[model samples]
Target: MTVLLTVLAGLGLGLSLIVAIGAQNAFVLRQGLRGEHVGLVVAVCAATDVTLIFAGTAGVGVVLERAPVVVDVVRWAGAAFLAGYAVLAARRALHPGALRAGTEGARVPAARVLTAVLALSWLNPHVYLDTVLLLGSVAGSHGGDRWWFALGAALGSITWFTLLGVGARWLRPFFARPAAWRLLDAGVAVVMATLAVLLVLRPV
Candidate 1:
């Protein structure tokens, strides 16, 4: 019973940390909506989160806390990437493309998708701060149960990403129109631009 409760606590915290309107989530949603390589995108995000959570439970957060410069480098790189992504989204919004459901449109190479997702997953410093530092520290508080906490966190991440990627197909009807795509792209642009600015001002 105690172990189950600890796992649940970790799950809740993991979900709380990720269920936000950030660059990573935005990119995932976009890929989900497009129905292009959703599996790969979700896999990368979930795997990265799980790996970092476990690393934190293993006391990597201590190393990170002692190395502020690493976080700064990621912050700057992430900001630049987000800024560039914002520009691309803005351009897409200006000239909205047709919504491609499943295998309906020109396929984006899987390799390209892989690269984009990898960048989005690794470049963001918040991933380190949240999964590595916050989650790690929290897991450590559980001592012997820390592994259970990490497991719960990993499960939370996997469940969320899987649901997000798979469930987005249900909204295909709504995204069928070019106008809807335009609106989504515009929102993505705004979100990415705002996040980029925030990272610059308060790099975490």
Candidate 2:
């Protein structure tokens, strides 16, 4: 029961952190809506999350906690990255050309999508904090069942990405309209801006 409880806690916390509106989730949703390279995108993201989670479990989390400077640096970098994405999203929301540029977005190359997936996953420092550091520390608090906690976190990532990627097809009709893209980009901008501000102002 103790092991089960630890895993459940990790899963819950992992979903809470990951499911929040952010750049990664926004990218996933876009790829899903496009229906191009969706499987590859989902696989890469889930794999990256699993890698970071285990790295955290193995001791990186402790190292991060000990080095307050490192966390501060990451916090600022993540804030900047998120804020930049917000600007791009806002631009897309306001520009008709930008929204219509990739109307047949299905033709986008797999390599291009993969490159973006990697950039969004690795370039964002938030992943390191949430997946490696935060999850690691919490898992360690579970004592001997830390591995189970990590596993649960991995599962949460897999499940969330799979659902987000596969289930996005259902909204295809809505996204078929230019107005939908405008609304989506606007929402993405707000979410990104909020997260960036929170990152900068939050106590490390």
Q: Highest TM-score among the candidates is held by which one?
A: 1
The C-alpha stretches of model 1 lying farther than 4 A from their native spots are: 97-105
Worst 10 residues of 1 by lDDT: 95-104
lDDT of each: 0.88, 0.85
lDDT of 1 by residue, 1-204 (tens): 999999999999999999988888888887898788999999999999999999999999999889999999999999999899899888877753432332246788999889888988999998998999999999999999999999999999999989888888898999877788888888989998998999999868
RMSD of each: 2.1, 2.4
For candidate 2, the TM-score is 0.85
Instruction: Kindly list the per-residue Cα lDDT of model 2 for residues 1-204, writing each as its tens digit.
Output: 888887888889889989977778888998899788899999999999999999999998777778878767767877777788789888889988877765453477889878777867875667888998899888888888999999999999999999999999999999989999899989989988987898888845
> For candidate 2, what is the lDDT?
0.85
